[model samples]
Target: MAWKFETSGLDGQCELFGVNIFKYRWRDCRETAAVTDPHYGVEKMFHVYEVEIDGQLRRFAAGEFSNCVWGFYLEQG
Candidate 1:
């Protein structure tokens, strides 16, 4: 299977500039748990990315994923 465009080149990013959230089961928690179980997702955290483009500060962040926007930039050296 091929990765969709939304997550493509995610590792090659010159700067990571966004909040990505996903629930991962852990600590013996599973959908089959009969008692109270909690799915752990990386709790919301503030993150910023900075890259020097033309000697200028290029800052990027996801702020809140409420909009679910993925941004990226590419340029020649």
Candidate 2:
């Protein structure tokens, strides 16, 4: 999927790849260790969260930079 960060509504809310994350019930947000990109060497900190959607538990990783939030809708295989 083409994951792109987009702003939603006038409240300064955000969505990942057009998914309205707030529509689901999320909890258990935990911060993990920072990681550096192997190619660019850019270090980033992430928070892992669990959200129940359609009776399935979905995981999400979110990070912030320049006051903008970016995240991954971690699809389990």
Candidate 3:
């Protein structure tokens, strides 16, 4: 993750009327992983699956749930 900052204002006060956190990194990554059987039991076996994006990868052995996408939609292709 990377970050940058900038200042702006009509009075050039840089604080009288300004902005914060102008931007953030929408990062990406990739790595080798294994596959699991989704029908091995009564529940889906999605224990540790590396997620992909646009036919590409972004993470490996991804098991974190606190940061999982609660919901998603194609705002843009």
Best by TM-score: 2
lDDT of 3 by residue, 16-48 (tens): 112211121223234222333222322111222
lDDT of 1 by residue, 1-77 (tens): 11111221232232332432222111211112111111233333333344444445543322232344333222212
The TM-scores, one per candidate, come to 0.26, 0.52, 0.16
Model 2, which residues run further than 4 Å from truth?
1-18, 29-41, 73-77
Off by over 4 Å in 1: 1-9, 13-43, 62-77
lDDT for 10 (candidate 3)? 30
> What's the best-to-worst order under lDDT?
2, 1, 3
Q: Show model 3 residue runs off by greater than 4 Å.
A: 1-46, 64-77
Q: List the residue pairs that clash in candidate 3.
A: none
lDDT of each prediction vs. the true structure? Answer: 0.28, 0.51, 0.23
**Residue 77 lDDT (model 1):** 28
For each candidate, how many residue pairs have backbone atoms clashing (under 3 Å)? 0, 0, 0
Ranking by TM-score: 2, 1, 3
Error at 58, model 3, angstroms: 4.7
lDDT of 2 by residue, 1-77 (tens): 22222232322365543457766666756655354433355766556678776677666655554455344434333
Model 2: worst 10 consecutive residues (lDDT sum):
1-10
Q: Pick the winner on TM-score between candidates 2 and 3.
A: 2
Please list the Cα RMSD from the true structure of every candidate, rounded to 1 decimal place.
16.8, 5.9, 17.5
